[model samples]
Target: PAVVNKIAAGEVIERPASVIKELLENSLDALSTRIDVDIEEGGTELIRIADDGEGIPADELPLAVTSHATSKLRQADDLFCVQTMGFRGEALASISEVSHFKIRSRTAEDHVGSELAVTCGERSDIRPIGCAPGTQIEIRQLFCNTPVRRKFLKRASTEFGYISEQFTRIALACPRMQLSLTHNGKSVHRLPATNELTERLTLFYGSQTVEQLIPIEAEHGGVRLWGYVGHPSLNKSTRKSQYLFLNGRYIQDRSLQHALNEAYRGLLMTGRHPVAFLFLEMPSDQIDVNVHPTKSEVRFRDQQFLFRLLLSTLRTKFLQSD
Candidate 1:
């Protein structure tokens, strides 16, 4: 069982950034208004996430680290309509299987919080303590028990870069949530809660980048698309700046990428890519989020219709701007 868990951990927790992504999703699922992330040595040495959200009860803390124990799913039917980010309940369990994990949480109704510590899937300690009305999780020596997985990690800088990008993506998706990130005791990003997407974009990209963005808003066949796309004059050599969100969740879709590229067919150079931050809103049943374990990729029910809608809407917007 231990070996099986370690193997599954490798699948979900591929790298330090993967751990960060899962934790951030959990925090968001908890309805956290503010999240603070701190990492050291690219999260290999330590990763701590604190959130101002509803905390776990003293008794549920243990089950939280148990495999397949999830609060997100009530029945088999709920699988098709998964609105929460961390549904499988594998993240905490998988993380605890390979790292020194500790969770301290207190609900508003509780006078004191409880802390549970687990090392390599073994319960080391559990105690009641005073804490704020939220959850704080601390992980140290990630993948210590799985040397093979640890060996595959890139350099600290490279790993940290992935972590930072993940942080920015989550922050962008939830613009109303305050987020803070620190690396090696140095502050990397400190974003305040804002209702405007452009304001959040300015914080993530910069004022100069925001100035070059064209606002896009269109609706077709019960789907609404709204976001900012870079002006024709503002092209990038790489597609790193392109970000697409579906129903407030970050996703990567080849068809959507092709639609975006087609919209900019004549404006951009052959090798250059247009920067965009596009958001798609459609009914939950129209798409499936369970296609990928990481939930980064989704499957749409009507691919051709979506492609046409996106291409036509974006093309019209670009033509109008021109």
Candidate 2:
């Protein structure tokens, strides 16, 4: 069973950045309002995520890392409408299999916290501990048991770059969450809670980019679209500036990319892409997220409808400005 976990861990635990992404999703799923991340040696040495959210019970600490065990889903039908960020339930188990993992949590009603450690799939008894009313998880020696994976890892600087990109996505997606990042004992980013998305936009893209952004929002056929689409003059040479999210979850879909391109085809010059931070909120039943292990890709039931809706939204906005 342990060997099976190690093999399966490879599917989701790709690298240090992968660990960061999964852990952040768990924190968000817990309804965390404030999250702090600390990384060392590009997260291969240590990755710590602390969140002020509802914590787990003392007894459930062990079940938290159990394979295929999750609180988000009760039946097979629950997979169709997963609203939480970490639903697969295999993430924590997968992460623990490849790394030295420990989770300490304390609920508001509990007088003391509970701490549990699972190192390389070896479970340790839950112990009583003292902590604040929240949860904190730490990962150390990631991929240490898998020498091949460790060898394939890039340099610390390059790995941290990937982690930074992941951080940027989560921070942007939840701008209202108080988020902070620290690398190698140095503070990299500290974003305060805010109601406006422009603050985060300016922080990430600069004042010039924010000033040129035009608000775009509307609802059609039960799908709500909101976010900023850059002016044609504010185009970029690459799609790196195009950030798309569905129901608050980041996704990479070719159909949506095509819709974006079709919307800006004549507006942008060849090889140029428009900057957009667009989000689509639709009924969870309308999409299927089980297509990927990491849930980064989704399949829409009526994809053409989404494609046309996106294209029309941008094209109409552009036409209005003209």
Candidate achieving the largest TM-score: 1
lDDT of each: 0.88, 0.87
Clashes of each: 0, 0
lDDT of 2 at 160: 94
Q: Clashing pairs in model 1?
A: none
The stretch of ten residues in a row with the least summed lDDT in candidate 1 is 74-83
Q: Per-residue lDDT for 1-322 in model 2, tens only?
A: 7788888899888899999998888888888899999999899899999999899999898888988888885443344332466747888999999889999999999999999999999999999999998999999999989999998999998999999989988888889999999999999999999888899888788999899998898899999988998998889998778888887778888998898888888887788998999888887778875586475778888999989888998889999998
Decoy 2 TM-score against native: 0.95
User: Model 1 over residues 1-322: C-alpha lDDT tens digits?
Assistant: 9999999888899999999998998888888899999999999999999998899999899999999999885443243332577758999999999999999999999999999999999996679999999999999999999998888999998999999989988988889999999999999999999999899898877899899999888888788988899998899999889999887778899999999888888898789998999888888778865576585787888988989888888788777887
TM for candidate 1 is: 0.96
> lDDT (0-100) at residue 117 of candidate 1?
96
